[model samples]
Target chain A: MGLEHRAKWRINIYAWLLLLPSLIFLVLFTFYPVLQTVILSFYQADLGSPEPFFNGGDNYRIMLEDDVFWKVLTNNLWFALGTVPTSIALGLAMALFANKALRGKGFVRTAYFYPTVVPMIAVANIWLFIYTPEYGALSHVMEWFGHGGMNWLGDRTNVMFAMIFMVIWKEAGYFMIFYLAGLQNISKELYESASMDGAKPWTVFRRVTFPLLMPTTMFVLIIAFTNSFKLVDHLVIMTKGGPDNASNLLLYYIYETAFSFWDQGMASALTVVMVVILLLVAAIQFFGLDKKIHYN
Target chain B: MRTVVKGLFSVLMSMALITGCSSGNAPATGSQAGAGAGSEAAAGSGAGKASGEKTELTFFYPVAVGGPLTKIVDGMAEEFNKANPDIAVKPVYTGSYQDTTTKIQAAVQGKTPPDVAVMLSTELYTMLDMDAILPLDDFIAKDGGSEYVNDFYPGFMANSQVDGKTYSIPFQRSTIVLYYNKEAFKEVGLDPEKPPQNWDELVEYATKLKKDGRWGVEIPTSGFPYWMFQSFALQNGKNLMTEDGKKVFFDTPENVEALQLWVDLAKKHQVMPEGVIEWATVPSDFLEGKTAMMYHTTGNLTNVKNNAKFDFGVAFLPAKKTFGSPTGGGNFYMFKGIDEKKQEAAWKFIRFMTEPERAAQWSIDTGYVATRKSAYETESMKEYVKTFPVAAVARDQLAYGHAELSTHNNGKVTKALNDSLQAVITGQAEPAAALKKAQEEADKILAPFNK
Candidate 1:
C-alpha cells in the first residue's frame, strides 16, 4: 500500500512537470492579461503609466453612457446571431452532402473548403473589388438585369449584411470540415439499420444521426460563438466600422479605443464586458447544454 | 488534459507569431532593417572611438500614399549615414500615419521610444500630452535659429507649432487639390484647361460632366473624412479649430452650411455618387473613368501620373469664401528622454533631409509639396516644375492653407468630427444636427485639456 502511494506521488510529480510549460504560458499570456484588464478597467490609465490613477469604475460608467458603445455591443450581438447559426447550418448541409459517394467528389470537396485556406484580409480585398460601385462584378450582374445595385459597403442599411455575407462565405467551409469529421465518425451500421427499418432519409437523420451528432454540434456552437466575438479583421479592411458606426462590432471598437484613441482604461472596461459575455456563453455550453448532449 | 492545454497554447503562440511576421514584412520597409543596422553600429562604435562613437538614431516613418516611398526613405537614410559617419541613422517604414503614431505611442509607454519619427503634423498635441517629444525651440536656436525656421512656408509652419514653440519640422507635406480628367472636361464641352474655380462653377461643371452612368466628382469620405471636410469648412470662411488648440467651431453656421453643401453634392445635386467615397480607391475609380474629378491629397500626384492614361489637370479646390486647403502630412519630431547629444544628431539629420537640394529631390521623387520655399527655387525643383506645371498648383495653394484641425485629445476630437461628417454624408443625419452633436462631443473631450 505504501509503495503504491509512493508511485502515485511520483506520477503526480511527473504530471506537474509536464504541465509546467503550459501552466506558465497560460498564466503569463492569458490569465494575467485578463486579470490586468479587470484591474485596468477600474483605473484612469493611458498606456505606459507606471501606476494608473484609480478612477472607481469611471470607465464602466463612461461606457454605459456612451451611445456608440451600446451600438457596437448590439452590433456584435447581431453579428453573432446573424453569422453563427447560418454558418453552422450551411456547414452541416455541406458536410451531409459531401459525405455521400459521388463522382468528382474530391474536386467538390476542395471547392467547398477553398475559402478556409485564404486569409481574411485577402478575402475582404476580393470582396471589396466585387462590391466596388460601378464596374464591380455585382454591378455588372445588376446592369444586365436592368437595375443598378446599391453600394454594398457604403450605405448603412447594406454594409452589415454585406460584411455578414462575406464572413459566412469564408467561415462556413471551416465549420464544414469539423462537421464532416463528425459525420465520418458515425457508424455505418446505424444508417443501414435505419434503412432496414424503412425510415426515410430525413427522419433517420433527425432521430438517429442528429442525436448522435449532438456532441459535435455543441462543440461547433462554442467555436462559432467565440469566433464571432474575435473576428474583426474583415471590418478593419472592408468597412472600418463606418457609415456612422452602423456596422461597428465590440472587438473592433475596443481596438480603436485602445490603439487609436489611446484610452487603455476604457478599452479594458470594454474587454471585461466582452470576457463576461464570453464566460456566460461558456457557462451555458459546459453546464446547461452539455447536459443534453450524449457522449459515446 | 495537459496535452490539450499545451496544444492550445502552442496554436495561439503560432498564430500570433504568424500575424506578427506577416504584418511587419508585407509593408515595404520593415523596422528590422533598423534593428539590423543598430547592431552593426554597435560593432563599429568601439573601433571608431578616435573620432567619436556614432549616435545610433532610429527614425520611423509612415507612407500614407502609394509609391515606392519606403525605398526612397531607406535610400535617403543610407546617404545620410554615409555622409555623416558620426551619426548612424536607421530608417524604419511603418505602415501608415495612423500606424506610425500608434507604434510610437506604444513604444513611448514601453520606454524604448525611437530617437526620431515622422508622424502626422496634427499628432503634435497627442505627442505633447504623452510627453513623448522634445520641443524644437532650443534645437532651432542652436542650429541657425529662426532664419532656418522662417525658410519653411508659414502654412506648413502653422501645423508644426504649439503655444508659440516649435516642436516639429515639416518634411513630407501636402494639400488637397482637385484632380480632373481633361478628357472628361473636353467631352463635356467645358474648357479642358480651365477647371472649376468656385462652388457654383464646380456644381455647374459637375452637372455638365455627368453622363452615361459615371458620376462627375468624388470627395472621399471614408479614411479621412474630417480632412476633406476641413477643405469645405475653410472655403466657407470658417476654420474648424482655433489656433490655440483650445476651442473648435464645428457647429458654426458657416461650417454647417459647408457640410450641407457636401451632403447636397450626393443627395440634392446628384453630381457625386450617392454614398461615401473611399479614399484609397478614389484614384483607381478616376483612372477607370468612373469619375471626372476627385478631391485628394497632392501626395497622390505621382500615383495618378503613373496610372492615368489621359491628360489630367491639378487645380486648387473650388472656392467659396476663398480657395483654401489645410496643409497635411508628416513632420519630423525628436522624442524626449534622449540625451542632448542624440537630440543634436537627430536635428542634424532633419536639417540634412530638409536641405534645398534634398528637399527638391524628395519633392520630385514623391509628389509632396516642397516644405521650404527655397526648395522650389532650387534648379532641380524649377526644372521639374517646368516639365510638369501641374505640380505647381499644390505649391501655390499654400497661400490659402491653414493648419489642419488639431486640439488636445486630437484623436477623439477628430473622430467626433469624422463620425459626424460620415453621418451627414451617408444621409443618416442632417448637416446642422450632426455638426451640433459633433461639437458637443468635441467640447466634452476638449474640456479637460482646457481646464
Candidate 2:
C-alpha cells in the first residue's frame, strides 16, 4: 500500500513536470497582463495625463456615456448575428455535400478553403477593390442586373452587411473542415440502419447526423463566438471604423482607444468589458449548453 | 515521505519555469531599440563606420504620397552619413501620417522614441500635450535666428509653432490643388488651359464635364475629410480653428455653407459621387479617367505626371469667395529626451536634409512643395519649374493657404469633424445639424484643455 501511494505521487510529479512549460507561459503572458489591465482600468491615464492617477470608475462612466462605444457594440452584435449562424449553416451544408460521392470533390474543397488560406489583411484589400463604387468587381456584376453603383464599404447602411458577407465567405470554409471531421467520425452502420428503416435523407440528418455532431458543433460555436469579437484586422485595412463608426468592433475600439487616442485607462476598461463579455459567452456555451450535447 | 519530497521538487521546478519565462520576456521592451540598432548596422555598412564611435540616430518618416519615395529618403540618409562621418542616421519608413503618429506615441510611452521624426504638422498640439517634442526655436536662433525661420513659407509654418515657440521645421509640405485631365476637359468642350476658378465656374465646368461612366469632380471624403473640409471652409470665409490651437470654429455659417455646397455637388447638382470617395483611390480614379477633375494634394503631382497617358493640368482649388487651401503634410521634429550630442547631431541632420539644394531636389523628385522659399531660387528648381510650370501651382497658392485644423485633443476633435463631414457627404445628416453636433463634441473633448 505504501509503495502504491509513492508511485501515484511520482506519477503526479511527472504530470506536473510535463505541464510546466505551458503553465508558465499562461501565467506569464495571459494572467499577468489581465491582472495589469484590471488594475489599469481604475486609473486615469491618457496623453493629457501621461502619468497615471487613480480615478475610480471614471473610465467606465465615460465609456457608458460614449456614443461611439455604444455604436460599436451594436455593430459587433449585428455583425455576430449576421455572420455566425449563417456561416455555421453554410459550413455544415458544404460539409454534407462534400461528404457524398461526387466528381471533382477535391477541387470543390480546395476552392472553398482557398479564402481561409489567405490572410485577413490581404482579403480586406482584395475586397476593398471589389467594393469600389463604379469600377469594382461587384459593381460590374450589379450592372449585369441593372443595379450598378453600390458603394459597399462607404455607405453606413451597406458597410455592415458587406463586412458580414465577406467574413462569412472567409470563415465558412474554416468551419467546414471541423464539420467534415465530425461527419466522418459517425459509424457507417448508423446510416445503413437508417436506410434499412426507410428513413429519408432529411430525417436521417435530423436524427442521426446532427445529434452525434453536437460535440464539434459546441466547439465551433465557442470559436465562432469569440472570433466574432476578436477578428478586427479587416477593420484596420478596410474601414478604420469609418462612415461614423458603422462597422467598428469591440477589439478595434479598444485598439483605437489605447493607441490612437492614447487613452490607456479607457482602453483597459474597454478590454475588461470585452473580456467579461467573452467569458460570459464561453461560460454559457460550456456549462449550460454542454449538458444537452450528445457525446459518443 | 518520498512522495512528498517528489511533490516539492515538482513545485520548485514549475516555479523556476515561471521565473524563467518572465526573465525571457524582459527583452521585449528593448526589442524596438534593438531592431533600430540592427537596421542601422545594416545601413551603416556602406558608410564604413568601423570606428564604432559615431553617434547613431534613428529617424522615422512617413510616405503619405505615392512613388518610390522610400528609396529617395534612404539615399538622402546615405548621403548625409557620407558627408558627416561622425553621425549615422537610420531612416525608418513608418506608414501613413496616422500610423506614424501611433508608432511615435508607442515609442514615447516605451521610453525609446526615435531621435528624429517627420510627423503631421497638425500633430503639434498632440505632441505638445505629451511633451514628447523639443522646441526648435533654440536651434533656429543658433542657425540664423528669424532669418532661417522666415525662409520657410509662412503658410507651412502656420501650424509648426505655438505661443511664440517654434516646435517643428517644415520638410514635406503641400496644399490642395485641382487636378484636371486635359484630354477630358478638351473632350467636354472646355479649355484645357483654364481650370475652374470659383464655385460658380466649378459647378458649370463640372456639369459640362459629367458624362456616362465618369464623374465630373471628386473631393475625397474618406481618410482626411477634415483636411479637405478645412479647404472648403477657408475658401468660404474662416479657418477651422484659432491660431492658438485652443479653440475651433466648425459650426459657423460659412463652414455650413461650404459643406452644403460639397453635398450639393453630389445630391443637387449630381456632378460627383453621392457617397464617400476614398483618398487613395481618388488619384487612381483620375488616372483611369473615371473622374475628369479631382481635388487632391499637390504631393500627387509627380505621381500623376508619371502615370498619366493624357495631358493634365494642375491649378488652385476653386474658390467659394477666394482661393484657399490648408497646408498639409509632415514636419521634422526633434524629441526631447535625447542627450545634447545626439540633439546637435539630429539638428545637423535636419538642416542637411532641408538644405535649399536638397529641398529643391526633393520637390522635383517627390512633388512636395519645397518648404524653403530659397529652394525655388536654386538653379535646379528654376529649370524644373520652367519646363513643368504646374509644379509651381501649389507654391503660388500658398499665399492663400491657411493652417490645417489643429486644436487641443486634436485626434478626437478632428475625428468628430471627420465623422460629421462624412455624415453630411453621405446624406445621412444635414450639414448644419452635423456641424453643430461636431462642434458640441469638440467642445466637450477640449473642455479639459480650456481650463
Candidate 3:
C-alpha cells in the first residue's frame, strides 16, 4: 500500500509539472489583467499622477451619467442584434446551397470563405471608398436608378446600419464554413429517411437538418455576439466614433478613454462592465442554451 | 485507458510548448536591448578611440497623414547624423499624433521614455502634468539665453510657453488656409485672383459657385472638428480658452454666433454639405472638383499641388471681426529622466534640424510652415515662395494666427467641444444648446485642474 501511494504521488507531481507553463501564462496574461482591471476600476488613475487615487464607485457613477457611454453600449447591443442572426441565417443558407450537388461547388466554397482570409483594416479601407458620397459604388448604382445617394457613413441614422451591413458581408462567409462542416457531419441517410416519410422539402429541412445544426448555430451565435463587442478596428478606420457617437462601441469607447483621453480608471470601469456582460452572456449561452442544443 | 492517457499527455505538452514559446520571447528582446547597449559603446569607441563616445538619442515622431512623410523624416535624420558626428539620432515614426502620445505616455509610465518626441503643441498641459518633459528654458539659458528662443515665430511660440517657462520647441507648425479652384472660380464668374475676405463675401461667393453637381465650399467636420471650429470662433472675435489654459468660454455669445454661421453655411446658405464632412475625403473632394473651395491645413498644399489637374490658389481664411487662425502642428519636447548628455544631444539635433536653411527646405518639401521668421528670409524659401507665390499665404497669415486650443485635460475638453460641434453640424442639436452642453462637460473635466 505504501509503495502504491508513493507511485501515485510521483505521477501527480509529473502531471502538474507538465502543466506549469500553461498555468503561468494563464495567471500572467489572463487572470492578472482581469484582477487588475477590477481593482483599477475602483480608483481614479490618471496616467500623469504618481499613484491612483482611491475613489470607490465614482468611475461607475461617471459611466452611468455619461450619455456617450450609454449610447455606445446600446449601439453595441443593437449591432450584435443586427449582425448575429442575419449572418448566421445567411451562413446556413450558403451552407445548404454549397452542400447540395451543384456544379462548381468547389469554387463556390472558396468564394464563401475568401473574406475570412482578408484583414479587417483592408476591408474597412475598401468599404470606406466604396461608401463615398455620389462617387462610390453604391452611389453610382443609385444614380443609375435616377435616385439621390445618401451619405452612408456621415449620417447618424444610416451609419450603424451601414456598418452592420459591412460586418455581415464580412462575417457571413466565415460562419458558413462551420455550418458546412456541420452539414457534412449529418449523414445523407437522414435526408433519405425524411423523404421516405412523405415529407416535403421544407418539412424535411425543418424536422431533420435544423435540429442537427443547432450545435453549430449555437457556436456561431456566440462568436458573432463576441465579435460585435470586440471588432472596433473598422470603426477606427471608417468613423472614429463620429457623427455624435452614433456608431461607437463599448470597446472603442474604452480605447478612446484609456489611450486617447489617458483616463485609465474610467476605461477600466468600462472594461469591467464589458467583461461582466460578456460573462453573463457566455454563462447563459453555455448553460441555458447548451441543454437545447442536440448532442450526438 | 493507456492511449487516452498518452493523448492527454501529448496535448498538455503541446500547450506547454506554445505558452513557453510566447512568454520566452519577451525576455530575449530585453536581453537584446542589453546587447545593443554594449555594441553601441563599442561602436562609439571604435569611431575615434580618442575623443569621448557619441551620444545616441531616440526620437519619437508621428506622421498624421499618409504620404512621403516617413521617408522625408528618415532623410532628415540621416542628414543630421551626417552633419553632427558626435550625436547619433534615431527617428522612429510612430503612427498619428494620438498614437505617438499614447506611446510616449506609456513609455513614461513604464520609466523608459524616449529622449525626445514630437508631440502636439496642445499636449503642453498634459506633458506638464505627467512631469515627463524637461523645460527648454534651462537649456536655452545655458546656451546663452533668449536670443535663440526668440527667433521662432511668436505665434508659434504662444503654445510653447506656460507659466513663464518654455517646455516645447516649434516644428512642423501650420495654420488654416483657403484653397480655391481657380478654374471653378472663373467658371462661376468670380475673379480668379480674388478670394472671399469676409463672411458675407464667403456666402455670396459660395452662392454664386453653387450648382448641380458641385458644392461651393466644404469644411470637414469629422476629424479635428474643434480645430476647424476654432478658426470660426476666433474669426468671430472669441478665443476658446484663456492664455493660462484653465477656463474655457464655450457658451459665449460670440462662439454661438460662430457656430451658427457654420451651420447656416449648410442649412441657411445651402452651399455646402448638410451632414458631417469627412477630413480624409475632403482633400480628394477638393482636388476632384467636388467642392470649389475648402478650408484645410496648409500642410496639404503639396498634396493638392501634386494631384490637382487645374489651376488653384491658396489664400487666408476669410475673417469676420478680424482675420485670425489657430497655429497647429507638432513641437519638439525632450523627456525628463534622460541624462544631460542625451539632453544636450537632443538639443543639438533640434538646432541642426531647425536651422534656417533646413527649416526652409522642410517647408518647401512638406508644405508645413517654416517655424522661424528667419526661415522665410532664407534664400531657398524666398525663391520657392516667389516661384509658387501661394506657398507664402500660410507664412503671411502668421500675423493673424494665435495658439491652438489647449487647456488642462485638453483631449477630453477638446472632445467635448468636438462632440458638440459635430452635433450641431449634423443638425442633431442647435448651436447655442450644443455649446452650452459642451461648456458644462468642459467645466466638469476641468474642475480638478482648477482645484
Best by DockQ: 2
Q: Could you tell me how far off, in angstroms, the CA of residue B66 lies in candidate 2 after the best superposition?
A: 2.9
All-Cα superposition RMSD per candidate: 6.2, 7.4, 6.8
Instruction: Give the candidate number with the greatest lDDT.
Output: 2
Model 1: C-alpha RMSD to truth? 6.2
lDDT of 2 by residue, B328-437 (tens): 88999998767555788999999999999999999998899999999999999999999999988899999998888888778788889988988887788999999999
TM-score of each predicted structure versus truth? 0.92, 0.91, 0.91
Q: What is the per-residue lDDT of model 1 for residues B1-451, given as tens digits with 9 covering 90 to 100?
A: 0221222224334434555555543322222345676645764684666456678999999997766889999999999999998889989988978788877875665556789999989888878878788888877897868889999999899988877899899999999999999999988788999999999899899989888777889998885699998998899997899887889999999988888778778888888987777777788889998899999999899989998999999999999989899989989999976655577789999999899899899999989999998999999999999999999999999999989988877768888888888888788888899999999999988887676
Instruction: Output the better candidate (1/2) by lDDT.
Output: 2
Please identify which of the two predictions, 1 or 2, would achieve the higher TM-score against the true structure. Answer: 1
lDDT of 2 by residue, A1-296 (tens): 69999999999999999999999978765666677778889999876775789999999999999999999899999999999999999999988988783898898888888899998989989999888888889999999988778877888899999999999999999999999999989999999999999999999999999999999999999888888988888887788888878788888888777656767789889888888998999999999999999898
Q: State candidate 2's DockQ.
A: 0.38
Model 1 residue pairs with clashes: none
Model 3, CA-based lDDT: 0.85
